[model samples]
Target: MSDAHVSLRDVTKVFPAANGGEGLHALGPVDLDLGKGEFFAVVGPSGCGKSTLLEVIAGLTPASAGTVEFEGWRVDADIPDGIGVVFQEDACFPWLSVEQNIAFGLRKTALAADAKQRRVRDVIDLMGLGDFAKSYPAQLSGGMRQRVCIARTLVTQPRLILLDEPFGALDQQTRLLMGDEVLRLWRQTGATVFLITHALDEATMLADRIAVMSARPGRLIDVVQTNWPRERDSRIVERAEFGAITARLWKTLREESLKTMALKGAGQAAEPA
Candidate 1:
């Protein structure tokens, strides 16, 4: 069997309108390959199709053309069990307690009750949600809610995890803390991750390689490899290489952001009153 964990071969997605008008072309004719157990990050300006790319990989949305393969099989339908997703929104069920929410997916599968319970408890403890396990979603802070969501996903032991702007709602300090937590979880699980974020610094800190995209109808502009040590501490960000990588990504994105803005302005000017 082929070893590529995730592969997008000239994939393209277009959204057809209800009125039979011209469709919106969202992505690809782009090629991407993610090796097994790699922490890959996709970074670009907002609306540059990064999230769309993630959705295609997760099988949440289908591509209009080309192929998406995960673990040597084509991803042609709804999300499969081997893939876990953590979206920006807190997706926990409101009525369930934190522990119940985390255990929800596991209970639906074929795992034994005892095994499910053990997995849920282990994730709750790992995520530091032991004290809040009995608390409802309404009782937790935003960061806490996100942690519960992540723990829920982790309990499934997925082969690939897709994170779409997972820390976008948190404050800077909390975002950093959550990033560290996510890194720890990935290391523990050894699952391949494909993260979508606009934060260049976050990408620089977490990614084994960062894929930078072009403006709308996004294409891969560059892929930057990060050679930093695997055991990253907070102080690692202070290193000269950290700033250098951040600067390189920023510079690439800056040009794309400008082009996107200019294209948007031109489109608005062309619209007839």
Candidate 2:
């Protein structure tokens, strides 16, 4: 009866060293809820466990404690059909053409051949990768490769999409263009999106609501609502209200960023056999 599409009840994650040394407490006791079709953004400083949190939701990593539920069912294990993920890297297969890469996951499904082709074609056009549909991953530009990554995810038509800094490696101009493209895809597909990014401007530009996280052993600090119009453009960043919101978020994030830096320094000092 509840409509909560994704719920994290006090979820935590800790990574143990491969050599069985001390564990890294990444995130903890974080309670969050995401409604269906919501464009949610998580922003935090490096090592704040933003990416780890996303991996938890994607079922790529298990939580050290607490629970994660997707669409009312516990997500303690991988359920491939229910989720799609786009990482910061271009994860497309080098040997596969753009269309083949998009169709890779669909091969296991019961979808008709026409349906699969239609889905692949639709996302190719949606992502503006029409001309590059037959190209291998090695042939595309960085931005174009990322678009292929997105198209591969979208072609599967998963109910939830997790994006971990999908454009972080790109230049500012390409990132902005890709941001618009992502929004356009979300609008057309109506998929619930959870994106993790370090870029404040991208968060403000793309998210319906932004969840701010604290430094190491990450916790939700605040969930800021954007006052900008749903139909947003780069010009929205020029508004006084936009500046105000970013300023407040910066106030929250700056302290955490500095704290993380100090922790990193301490970590470096203590690193030894």
Best by lDDT: 1
lDDT of 2: 0.87
Worst 10 residues of 2 by lDDT: 227-236
Give the per-residue lDDT of model 2 (tens digit) for 1-273.
Answer: 256899999999878888999888899779999989899999999989999899889999889999889999888857546699999987989999988998996877798899889888888888888898888989989999888888888878888999999999999999988888888778777889999999998988888889889998999999998855556666666778777777777889999999999999998999995
Worst 10 residues of 1 by lDDT: 227-236
| Segments in model 2 whose C-alpha atoms lie over 4 Å from true places | 17-22
Tell me the spans in candidate 1 whose CA falls farther than 4 Å from its real position. Answer: 267-273
- Model-by-model lDDT, in order? 0.90, 0.87
